[model samples]
Target: MELAVRAPTSATVDDVEDVLEKKKQWILETLYGLVEQDDPPLDKEYLSSEKLLYNGRRYRLRVEESSVIEPELIFDGNRFDLLVPENDAINTRRKRQAVVDWYVTEATQKLPKRADDYIQKLGIDDIEIEVTTLQRRWGEYRPGHVSLHSRLILAPRKIQDYVVAHELAHFRHEEHSDAFWNTVGTLVPDYRERREWLRVKGSTLTV
Candidate 1:
């Protein structure tokens, strides 16, 4: 990533110096245009373009230009990575299984083996971990199981740990009630701030 800096100029008008404020804006616009032209177009046809591991299961990506307004994952017998166009609401559902399957293998190698340890510390048990891609939630704890979005791999390590701890707390308390929060606090005292940070910056995780 390159940044363009513009020098300010001074011009006297009515004994007042006119600062060249617009130069900075112009330079930034020029840099953005150049970057756009130089960057390669986003390949929307390659399925399994990127891989991520949540828990232990490997997920393959499927990219397509569809009418769906938002990017989403489809699990229709097989996982499908779906990318929709904002303007071109096309119905193209091209499927690519594993163009880059190595990503899953690599990501799995990076996952922690003792993912449930943190929850166990809080006296919770009988919870399973599942890795998936969810647009809105980072982690969820259902009855006897927990689903963690594979996108969490994009988050910082501390934040990811916070998410894990949060879900684990749910095993004891199902809702976001006071009891649930107190349980989370026992594991991660600053979980609220980390949760807020993930909410605000979650979009940055996507490629």
Candidate 2:
């Protein structure tokens, strides 16, 4: 971790030293917290023994070699069977990307239908839904478009539904006011529970 401090242009070295001296405890605590983090997904190496969370269930990965075509990842309700192209090197980053591609493809197939279900239920039309990687947010909504984070496929099915409902609710009310939450509740009565689940476990949803 790099430490950077921004002070007023006219500030002296002594001023900066005094400020850092005062808040040293808070800074150390923050740095130590980051250093001690052990989030499995964030540190995934994509090895065969390393497991992945799909639809909120844990499954170990099994790698195999195939010469005919491209790499393919298959889910058989028990494990992830990945068929790597025989000529390609099964390096960590490549395997991780294969897993990420699988998640994006699965999200492409699944999220649209779920969003459409809510769309039909809410009688909202003309809102385009997209699946892609997002730097921070799980779902985004504008006037006529919504983009869902591809990594959201790692979440439970109910949580996925909540994200869709949350974005669709924005079609009616763009802000998180009571009226907006009421609309979301109308669409998904148990959204609060799913939202809570995300708050507690969402950070682990990574490739």
Candidate 3:
């Protein structure tokens, strides 16, 4: 998070300034990279044609509002069909929540199936999976339970599997020692690529 420059004692002020100007592109890229790690959540108005991610694929959201109908969301393979109350035209929060809630609900139903695959592979049992909002990490592990960020459901299947494997590896090794990484590798050999993708793009996984 720190950026510094060095200059010889004999160098004039203009020389240092010139150095900064010459390297401005690099300095800006470096700063932008740092900011991207914790980039702000993706902002949306929940309107038609907007992009929504699920299982690592971008699908256009089609919003339909009605006065007498209940607000609901449906995924029909091609895109999301969002049915909302007529007031959603002026009040977007409710429409947005419908989408968020759908993701959590879907995550609860589907994500656990993936976790079960790994659990069997790792030969573990009685592990509960909770999909909820996680602030700082993609996944966290305790002794007998695994909590995944609901947003993680937005990632591709491989990426999601890597995270699950990562947390499950902690079961065998609490600390991130060499044995832990070796275990992770067994589950996800390309974890480096998946981890890097999440690091750079995790912030964008939002409704």
Candidate 4:
């Protein structure tokens, strides 16, 4: 099987490589299981026939091979028209990277804004927001910063919003204590449902 590591900018190559080394067995096992089950709808293969999710909407990818200068992605609410260089069109790994790059760009632009809004509502102004790659978590929070996963861009807006609030709530309590959960509930009344949704479908959302 093929393996690719799209790590956070702050991570060094060595650090990413170390993580991959540690998780190689787990990764191989997961991939084998997914392959056996035929996988969820969108397995991030980046094939033209695969379905993609954007803000809770399902879209099928339609690749238009062209002898153009660069790859281009266009979404007209129904489908993703990915115009790729003829050479890149047939390269599955390259196509996957292109689609993931688009998702990262969108996440960088939109996720931070959503987090900022939640930060304001939480009345916390000292926290910094950054879009990064997190393989095992949707968002991670520290004393002064929060790193949101770029993969979140594919989920619905409400789910994304819930994650922001959940992270922001961390500032009030370091652990997932009752107080911290209360803070999240105050910010998002239906957070339980959102958490449930993530528990059920989060595994299928991968790069």
Q: Which candidate number would show the highest TM-score if scored against the true structure?
A: 3
> With candidate 2 superimposed using the best TM-score fit, by how many Å does residue 48's alpha carbon deviate from the native?
2.5
Task: Report the alpha-carbon TM-score of model 3 versus the true structure.
Answer: 0.78
- Model 3 over residues 80-163: C-alpha lDDT tens digits? 988877754446777777888889998888777777777888898878888877756777789888888787788898878988
What does candidate 2's lDDT look like per residue over 99-152, in tens digits? Answer: 888888999988878887789888989888999877557887889999898877
Model 3 lDDT-worst window of ten: 27-36
Give the better candidate number (2 or 4) by TM-score: 2
The local distance difference test score of each candidate is 0.55, 0.79, 0.78, 0.77
Error of 3 at 165 (Å): 0.5
Candidate 4 per-residue lDDT, tens place, 85-113, comes to: 87553566767767788889999999989
Which one wins by lDDT: 1 or 3? 3
Off by over 4 Å in 1: 1-103, 106-114
Clashing pairs in 1: 48-61, 62-81
lDDT for model 3, please: 0.78
Off by over 4 Å in 3: 1-35, 38-42, 67-70, 86-90
